[model samples]
Target: MSKTYTNSSTKFSFALRLIVVYLLQLFIKAFDYSFGGVFPLTFRGMIFTFTFVTYWLTIWYASEYIQKKISHLNTISIVTINVLIGIYCGLSSTVIYMLGDTYLFQNGDLWEEIPFYNPELSVALCIIYLLIFTVYAYVQKIFQLKEKEVNVEQLEKEMFKSQYIALKAQIEPHFLFNSLSVLSSIVHTDQNLASEFIIKLSKTLRYIIEQNKRVLVSLEEELKVVEDYFFLLKTRFGEAIQLQNDIDPNVIETIMIPPASIQVLVENAVKHNKLSQKKPLCITIALKENLIIVTNNYDKKEAEEISTGMGLSNINKRYQLIAGKNIIIEKNQDTFKVSLPALSTIDHENFNH
Candidate 1:
């Protein structure tokens, strides 16, 4: 048999609340007796107190049942049902009290002194039920807020980890080797152009370093990095690799995205596809329907590239954390395209700093 672990915290809370309600009932009874100018610890008083505690516990159980069943109910229906439950609890408490007085105490005058049905007692019980429900609701709200805070913290940590991993991948030994080889080839042929290429490569590296400290960057800033990266690519491959850019000026300043997103997409295109004079690789960047679309021809090399495929996966995870959106990837026989979310400046500021 499987052993079931009971929720100790829930049981402790219920016990504490029961003690509080019992003390509150005693206080109210004492207040009433003060007016009568008599207070005594009689057997009748002990029995009455016990009955009251039992009555409140019944209402507590009923409230739990209502909460479990009526979650999907509309506001009006839930309120109506809860009100009826309170009325029933009030009526039941009065019956339990009268029965204790008549049978347990053996008091013949109970019928004459305290009537079988007391409207005032029922109303008072209903009010108590409402107060109890209100307190329960407030406590539940506090728990929900705490849970949400924990979830947000976990997500922020995951986002930062993804970004760090992507940076490591971009700055690995193989990438540095290729870039240095390109720079070495141009040094003898065109010294001025080689100088410009070195500057562009430096600028691209500087941007990556700066952006690693931030969760998001403006589209305009990201575009500058992309331009520098493309300049290096164009210098290295010359006419073999071409970038076709058509970006809207208005969207650049207003929209934001995770740092180095466009560069990763462009680098992915270059890495997977073959580039030569006969079959030039042409990559396109454009804006469409509130998204930044980056596409390239699907001319995959015969051998598969050695990669963990974390480029797009990391970008997608970061987008979800920053904008609560998804990156759309589409592939056909000849084209591969990815559409990224274009977040507003306000949305960018709303993320965890």
Candidate 2:
């Protein structure tokens, strides 16, 4: 709300500045005609200064009055008001100048007498002034439209950032809980295995924290984090969790993705299913054409059905927004597969490592 007020104030300030500059130009023109005239220019300067200032003040007041009275006025109404304002200002300036001449300069035997006031000239001046005002209003309207477009783009970027941060926050707690459970199970049986798990977990967490600040990470960096995550999962499940990858080296160097996206999909597969010696969890990561595919064999035990479905939904939303592509899901009776479009980048070898 305070920001809105500030913006409105800034807009008002801009309008005020424009008006001041316009008035200054009119004053300068008046001085050029009066003070820079043929003979001694004092009396003419005084009359012209008074006429110019009075005209500017009257136009400003009339415009403000019309705008306030018809705050929701249409374009036609505004133009009508402007035309009327131009006529009134021009006529008022002429009348004031004529009155000044009659009252003060009646001893008209000066070196050269000013010309008599002409009503036809005043009418022509009003028409010209109104035309200029109309053009100025049209230009102002164009600028206002451009300003609105900029504001809209800024707001959308802000909204995307906010939603991205919220989604990241949701996944972190879910990830931490699962990883800590795995660590707890391994602590008592194999101390060295538990230590190794801790190291891998630390690396994964570090990656998440560091990459959360960025919107994208190289595919290679993301794959490294996924490999560390796979180690932790493999440590927990032993031979029950089988993982394979067939990623293209060429694609890896030129593609980027949101950090932890693959990890989330893999984690979802583990969380929603059962892993045992007889029914192992087989997960495969492969790149086919322009798609990165993650597939897992479905073998959920009756007792273990703890799927929330948020991870896949979140990843889908992020991918759609970032890449302008849909995350495709293919499901059969025996397997579930997710295919994400690989996001291209400018640097060919940026993700080589």
Candidate 3:
């Protein structure tokens, strides 16, 4: 469908260009018979023809060039520009016509013989033709601008679709099953703890559901959800998993980051590394040099239990679409780190939807 539309648009544009090219010739031919026997088909007549067509094409495209540069278009501005071009084109065309006849054609005394040789009539015709051509140029510019807007909207829609798929991928079945299995075992022995577990589990699920709700979120809001997710993880893993948050409190309310970024990083770290009381998988989140840094100790597990491998990739995509920024990743034998650009509060409204 898009191809068909593009082909049709190309055909229309080609046909329109041909018509514009011939319109000036038509205008020149329309006045050719006015000279009759007084001005024959000679070098002088061809000179007038060249002058009219050249001047017409020059002003016509010049108006379009102006249209492209004017960021804001309105009736008054268009009218002002059109009137100026019309006057310039009309006065200059009349002078060119008179000069060509008086000097080149040696027909200065024949203006009375030629009915269409009146200067007022010549100027009026020039202004009228210019008005028509300039108006067409203005409308063509408007359509091009509208086409650009449509393309941008289509691009945004595609980005949002990717965001939805990424959000869905954040929910892990293994995490859910393991959390539920742990919950069932402790409900009787630790009723109070079980209740707390249920609450954190609900919050974790709710956080997943609310992903992609907005393009940007405050650090405070994102950390609260991350805390809920961490609570569930710690409750299940006991001393085997630990998270240390050292984000600057002063900027928590003022700085923004992509949603689910910290949670995804923490989840990714736990999935890829070994975790036990002997060597705990320690995850740290901190604000350093205007960056939200997530780091985890390296402990190679012979085999990872579950990894869709989309966690970090999805975070990178969301950050790009939301803030036009890229997340930085650095890893060595001892540690894996991801650095997310900290956004400002003033720009939150720019990415809300």
The most accurate candidate by TM-score is: 1
Candidate 2's TM-score reads 0.49
Q: What is the clash count of model 2?
A: 0
Q: How close is candidate 1 to the true structure, as a TM-score?
A: 0.62
* Order of models, best lDDT first: 1, 3, 2
State the lDDT of candidate 2 residue by residue for 1-353, as single tens digits: 32474487567745764565355545444543434542334766655655565566566555756766876889798778777777776676566656665567673333134444446545655776676566655665775676555544543453355445434643567666867888888799889988988888788767755654555677888888889989988876789898888897666866787667888788778877888878899999999887899999986667764655666676665565455467899998899999987887732232212
Give the per-residue lDDT digits (tens) of candidate 3, residues 1-353. 33355576667755665566456555545665645533357676566656666666676667667766763788788677767777777667666776777787777775656444456656776667665766676666776676546544543563465456545644557656888899998999999989998998787777666654566778998899889888888888999999999876777999987777787788778778999999999999988898999999988789765665566776776666555678999999999999999988765776565
Top lDDT prediction, candidate number: 1
- TM-scores for all candidates? 0.62, 0.49, 0.58
Which candidate, 2 or 3, has the higher TM-score? 3
Estimate the lDDT of model 3.
0.73
Worst lDDT run of 10 residues, candidate 3, spans 150-159
Task: Please identify model 3 stretches exceeding 4 Å from their true place.
Answer: 1-172, 305-309
RMSD of each: 9.6, 15.0, 7.4
